[model samples]
Target: MKLLFFVPLLVVALVASTFAQQASWRPVDTKILSPWAAEIDPANPHPEYPRPQMTREDWVNLNGLWNYALAPKGAGMPEAYAGEILVPFAIESALSGVGKTVGKDQELWYFREIEIDRSLRREKLLLHFGAVDWEAEVFVNGQSVGTHQGGYDPFYFDISEALQSGKTQSLAIRVWDPTDEGPQPRGKQVNEPRGIWYTPVTGIWQTVWLEAVPEHHIRSLKNTPDFDNKQIRVQADVAGATAGQRLRIRLLADGTPVGEQLVANQEEAVFMLDAPQVWSPENPFLYDLEVALMDGKKVVDQVNGYTALRKISTARDANGIQRMLLNNEFVFQYGPLDQGWWPDGLYTAPTEEALLFDIEKTLDMGFNMIRKHVKVEPARWYYHCDRMGVLVWQDMPSGDMGNRWESRPGVIGKGTEKDRTPESEAIFRKEWKAIMDANYNFPSIVVWVPFNEAWGQFDTEEIVEWTVDYDPSRLVNGASGGNYTLKGQIMDMHNYPDPVMPDPQIWGDQQVIVLGEYGGLGLPVDGHTWQEKDNWGYQSFKNETELQERYSRLIQDLKPLIPKGLSAAIYTQTTDVEVEVNGLMTYDREVIKFDPAFLRNKHQELYTIKIPMK
Candidate 1:
């Protein structure tokens, strides 16, 4: 948490001109642009710290103008630089200044020069990437460092060995993304943008940076809260832990120390709290954590983070109907099917403020939960949710959409599974576990959604069983809006234009009943639509009045199901994506189709009702 040393004056003067040169570069003009695009400074695009949970003050942001080239897939490295592209923006995005698609046969290349301050590069220099599209191979000064796959998870390479013995170092990255051509976990991305699918995001689309750490520093932390025990269980993975080094953890409430623990070379540590405040939507309490690796009196490494104490489970109501219980209370969860997409940024939001807007707006609509449909947002999004008390249903981005799904009223059927190759299954398994582990510390996520509408559902019983066993902290919705396995904690149903719930007679005693998706009321704002014509929604509306009336009626119809056994419900979406105009807000986030106050008032009925828990 504290800077080890001060920056040299010579280094500051040297990098000032480099930042100016970087800022002078500009993005190419496009047909449409978001409001944040105009305020972007190439020198500091997404300059905020990428990882909030793991904070280190001394780090270099590698987001700026970078040399780029597109070559054949197996071409290795390009002989010549093609042009300059923005570091964090996707190559296909207009904000990148090179709106060119890298097809299945092509590989995208990025080159940049990094000025390393000798003072900051102490014992180890680590390069961190928030995310890269499909696959990325890193090179430092033409020396191959490492290769990483999976587009949605964070990865880092120890570039200390590859750094040259000079003030400046050359960094190059080669990437290959197949979009929908391969069976990777790409969420709704395609070469051809259509009704539900959007443009392909190739190459780097997230913040890249470099950090300095000790030789034996903490690599990652997994915090699990035990409300019953009134203590927090922490697992700290150290990169180069030595024999005598110990992990010291200090828990803080509002910056004041509450408890402390010192574990001897062990991976796990427990901190007891005097009076722990339970985390919920109403309280949203968070405790600061200071973790360090110490050798007696000297501190080797330290990082600051925060966590919350909460629990999610299921219980039966007075009528013997199963319902979702958050922290032992039967509070109904209702939220929109949040497809985290931006018109200007596509898969990436223009800024942190832009990304936080969706969550803030969701809460303003009086909804406490959000189903992040088939997309994983940056770590900061979950951090915001933790701080703001918004419950999340995190969905594993769907891939390998080559299966037939069967679902009918009053019938629970096992859908035909896709016969995917072993390689495909392995890829899915690896990425899903990585995603879960990466976000396990966040207390806001209440449910883990593995499959959505059976897009690539396979080995349903095994996958669900494994997922439930992997992290028993949160409830598992095996396949939201997909064929029900009736194995996990929730039996979900999908119905459009009206709210619907699973039959309580069949699944009420076993699993919680929920409306996975419903009420896609569409009203395309003329100027804010993705396309001029043929914009689509599940149910189309001509004006705001009609849309608002239909939405109110849907909620009105949904009230009766609460007595029957509806646990939760998800509306169509948070915002309009591409040509799909069913969002509460438009694609450009310019207008809210309904009055926020009126919608908030309508949503209150679902949350305020108290169903007796048996």
Candidate 2:
């Protein structure tokens, strides 16, 4: 009788388990994945620390699989979920294990379980999200905590009070992204993926995690290296400083003490160094830092960080024309027009190694700078550039691109600017400021590009003036390949198939002339393209030999512009994206069409010519 009773119960249990698996599981779609994607453990995705500038030893990564459902945009909450989708990967991406699209009228929902240690519960619990697309509303144990409304910047919430009883608690997130239908800064994302426009990234496209901190902690840090003075200015933003709390900062160079500073109540201090190592592409050096909040001598909170000492400015070259100077020297900046995207993960790379791959490959291609076009990458991407010694020209992603763009070379043309709605303008300004503040610590970024090719360009004069005044430490390219704005330092132009400059005879006297984009030579290899048909490039080639020969000729043609007051040049791209097959490598990153040695030898000859002052 006992055996018979247990047998039926076991059968029921087995059937239930099978049904659950069938409802909540799906295989990853057929797409090109990096080697790192194969190594991803769904139990713990993105295990590495997300914030390189401010890091704590005690934290938990909340990536991995979560219960997910797609519902109407106005839907409050679904009592039941549809399936499971991978966190940190967009719902529309193949790596999410659910290659489904959520349109403008729908909202994506996520549910997961979280646990907190009883001992650590005494301290304040904070939830941190590296990023979420468009807008996100977070909840803890059935209670709403907060809502964040930015697709690119990081935001957090204090969910300590919302935690229910027991070690385990419920966590939920709701996300909505309108892609191109909205007037927000959506970058290149579009509901209908086509040439140059990519599939929309919706919900948690970056690492999500938790941290336990004391009542008083270091909320943020700003480290600015004054190269001329041999000192580093430090500012700490304390979250909960009591009456007698203080802040201390210690600077180190490879474990050796270089300088230290302490301030009472006030959060500003300067550390004068003995011998500062100048950071550059050839010899990239970083100084280690330890920041602490203390009650007299008792340590309250501590964090680890690092910074680089370098300078980027604009000055007249040997000629009377304006030129960009790096570390007080005139070196022509050459790099690819990098559009940050992936086949499997969309906006998110499969892994940290995959994130570093492009920078490493760019360095291998003998390029010192990268014009990061129309999109902001994860913080780790810039961290790699800082450590690897590659400079960056970061662009504010374009949206509401209704402006009439005029690309008439040799003619100074100011394109008709877009008239953004009050709400849309507010959204752009808020997000742009947040993006700048979040990335100000990284030393690799030398230029901040406000507009690109007149896409969503507006209020050129005022916006350019505001950008220049906001961050005088870095050079501002107000409009790259866009209108001929009389603000900012560089006059940039974009030309296809061949190298071209911004008419040195016109804008050379006041601003630096540069070819912001050019040379999109394309050769699509079979089995490596995103689609079988309709794949295109700015200039198509029949074979590897033709592509290589044409590429070398373009570089040879580019060198003569340097003597004519051209300060820099950017090639079309680092990898193929979507239907655009104008990359040095394939979309899958599986093939490099040209020989590296041949390309490097050709690029080296461009730098050998000396620039003499007039």
Candidate 3:
């Protein structure tokens, strides 16, 4: 990862200012105003524990400011330094302190210094990036440590060997992201921001930190809840350990130990509670977990975690119609279409508090569910959802569509569908499997959406079956909006500016009716928009009163459809993106747009109405 180069001092100073300008060193009008906003001290911002699910009291927080520079395509390391840009925000975002675009050609370089604690000399130190858009190369004190690709997944590298004692450790990173120009699994990020698409997020857009662990440490763990069997399956993947290492796992409920077991390296163990407490929106009970690596009688490494009890499946209701069952009963689902975006940070939130605020607002809006559209959030996000009692329907991020012409909409209602190439199909399948494997343990995620609006959609039947086989405990939405084959459990439809119900005849016997997306009421408040002109929505209104009136009307229209078998409905979105102004909240999350009281009343009305099975 080492790059050798030289740059004139004048050129370095010029580039430093340019980087700072692009990173939005001057605050914009649309910046989110929170109580904690002014307290973001570069020295101690986001000091809260990063991983809520797997808690370790001994770990350190390595967030805050970092030195940054933008290099031209194929440029080597610069001799001089650039100004400081906030760590974890993309260069294209306002919060990054650099709002410049990192195109397919250029590379974004980041350099930071960290002082290692003197007491942890014998421990192995690992550098972790929650996520870096596309690809990243790491260097520790001028020595190459590792490199990683894939934008939505977390990766780490052990840099203990590259460290020197009694000196500040210098960490350097080089990132290259093609975004929409490449065939990577980037969700909705495009070089040119447009309707429903967003500005490209390049370089580190998530938390970056360093952790010190023993030679034999807990690498990863998975918790799967089986409500029907009344057992939880726990799998541990220990790293830097010997083959015969024994790991002890203890399951606790309300701080009381329920079950304990010992397993060998990289093995799965089942722990049964005396009386399992099933997880649901009404009662979200999580069992505290503690796992320790042992060498005979001594504990080598330990980590704390938690798990919830829940079950998701399709079963016959009292009226014999297929419905989504949670904890063995039918519960109508309703939520917003969450497209994880921020005006300041783009992919990353300004801080962990900001991230939690979005989830909290979604719950406060009186909805119990959310369709996580195409983007995978950090583990902490899902942990918040689990703790806040919000159900999640996770979607696999779409891939490249080789035949763009065939995928584009032709007439007002007609569309072209083409057969996918074998290579494209194989790639899609591989990535989809990886996504499911990575997020399978979360109890809040009940449904797996394989395709959305027919993006790279092929072999629908096969993919749906594959999803079921990969994780049979959850429901499957074969296709979210269009090109439905009636293969999945939910018969989902999409309508904008108005609500629509699926044709019962096409989904009469097997599927439960659900409005996957509808009601995009947009109002772009001045000074809070990404761009002034061409700010569009599915249905735009001039003022908050009009938006609220239209929203209430839409809900009133959906009332009769409940009796006609509408089981669930997800409104257009939670917040607006770059040019798409249709959001309940503004892009910066500064304004709620509509009256909260009216919206909450409408939400309560929607939830209270019982759908007839017939």
Candidate 4:
């Protein structure tokens, strides 16, 4: 959130030619070489259900195309639309059909018209945006309906009152994203992108749609799977309902009823399952769920959902060293440092297939986990992780205050820790809690990381404890690879181009040893980079063969550390991010740097599961 100051002399010249050329961008037909390049269907793009965990078959998909306009700094709503930008892609992204940066001072607007069915008109109409970066003010039928400020979480507005009873309705949105110029949790976005920091996303970057629900509908459902108790707690947050309203929750395994429970109002109800199938990397079993809101006897609202059975905790191993236990067993966690960047969509994936491709590739490479570095992904991303058997270390998007060059170092690391102001601390806490509340239901997310490499880090001990209390079921990485007070589950370290383990003496009993981040082996591919020059990685390679060889050597070196009590290691990244050309895959997902089978075999060799009895 701390604004970076740039001297006037440092400002690059505005190249009108580049802007003009990119503004007319559209999703290219992938019938040629790169078949994986996301294709835009004129009739149905990203028509699949957005929220896989909580799905309803009756909802409409509003994802093909929409009217878009970019107004000047502080300009009011425009009278004429500039052009058609694809819905759900950020205005700055190539897939949006309008690849133009929305600066801190500018406003990005979107307008779309939709018709409601007479059957749906009987129910309340709710408009949902999977996510809109920074700040968004929404208008329904020319009247301001609501305003929401948060980039990562989904939000909705009830527009039943504003709806035209028997005609088509209009929805307009005006968004303002300061990116790194404001004190909000803008993940890795920067005005002048370099290294890990990449392109900024402004306006709607996720699915936007409408759902018709009864007046007293089930607003939100939070399901917590407790393997320790062998029970799944279901909590329904109902809207427009009274105290005595009854809701029935049914749990099913492979579509067969396993358990059922009836609860009233917003209370936590438990459904006990017999011999529950616990979720793990090898077998990620999820139980189907259905919730119905009842008004006396008539069913008023219903929502279909799912939950996984899993547990994460810390326990001392045979050597008296603390270790992270998944499903009650010590498993050495090895995963990529996922930056969650898309070549075409920036923060948003061009298509759902593209989103799943990253996860599938990660799994194919023989890693069972991924440290989702500094960003929270869409709910469906986590849902895929749950289904595909991958563990996730979720980092709370950081904000507040820090020096770009100091706190976030390039070649060297050195920074004076600045105390966070009371106001900044309050905002940080609010956003952190909101993020947890939104993502606590995910089973694949076994760890909650509060700070990364000391970026805007403050009150480490207290915040770590707060995270532990917030969700006792998961482990907390107090601080990953930075100024550490040694107060969390993992004593994390960051050593790029080389791997390093925390001192066993200092954190022998307090925390599990982990190489939080390492091995940024860079290989930039031509015509697939955000910028030609100024690209970097910890170690740069000329081609894929060299990259794979160096990566295999790094993994071989990591094998000795596991016996030394190193429980986990997160490699630099899963895919190339903007200027950081160090990933298993290229930025556009056009190349796989290493052979998946070979990489998997190398990773499996490090685990104790395959070690011979000598």
Q: Give the winner by lDDT.
A: 1
The local distance difference test score of model 3 is: 0.75
Query: For model 4, how does the per-residue alpha-carbon lDDT over 233-309 read when each residue is reduced to its tens digit?
Result: 88898888876679998999999999887898787879787788989999999998899998788888899988988
> What Cα-based lDDT does every candidate model obtain?
0.86, 0.84, 0.75, 0.78
Ranking by lDDT: 1, 2, 4, 3
Pairs clashing within candidate 4: 1-183
For candidate 3, lDDT tens digit of each residue in 155-183? 78999899986758888898988878766
Better candidate by TM-score, 1 or 4: 1
Per-residue lDDT of 59 in model 4: 78
Instruction: Please give the distance, in angstroms, between residue 330's alpha carbon in candidate 1 and its true position after superposition.
Output: 0.7
Which ranges in model 1 have alpha carbons more than 4 Å from their true place?
1-31, 409-413
Better candidate by TM-score, 2 or 4: 2
How displaced is residue 453 in candidate 4, in Å? 1.2
Decide which is better by lDDT, 1 or 2. Answer: 1
For candidate 2, lDDT tens digit of each residue in 1-614?
Answer: 00112233443355345435554443365455544555556777778899998899878899989999999998798899988888899999887988899978999999999788876577788999998998999999989999988898998998889987899999999998888999889899998888888889999999999989887888998888788788887788889788788888888898998888887645667887777888898888999889989898999999999887888887776667888888878878999999889888889888887888888888877888999998888898988999999989999988988888788654544779999999888998988998899999999999999999989999988888898898877888888888879798888888887887777766888888888888888888766688887899999998888898899789888888888888889999999998889988887676777666676787777677677644
TM-score of each: 0.95, 0.94, 0.88, 0.90
Better of 3 and 4 by lDDT: 4
CA RMSD (A), model 1: 6.7
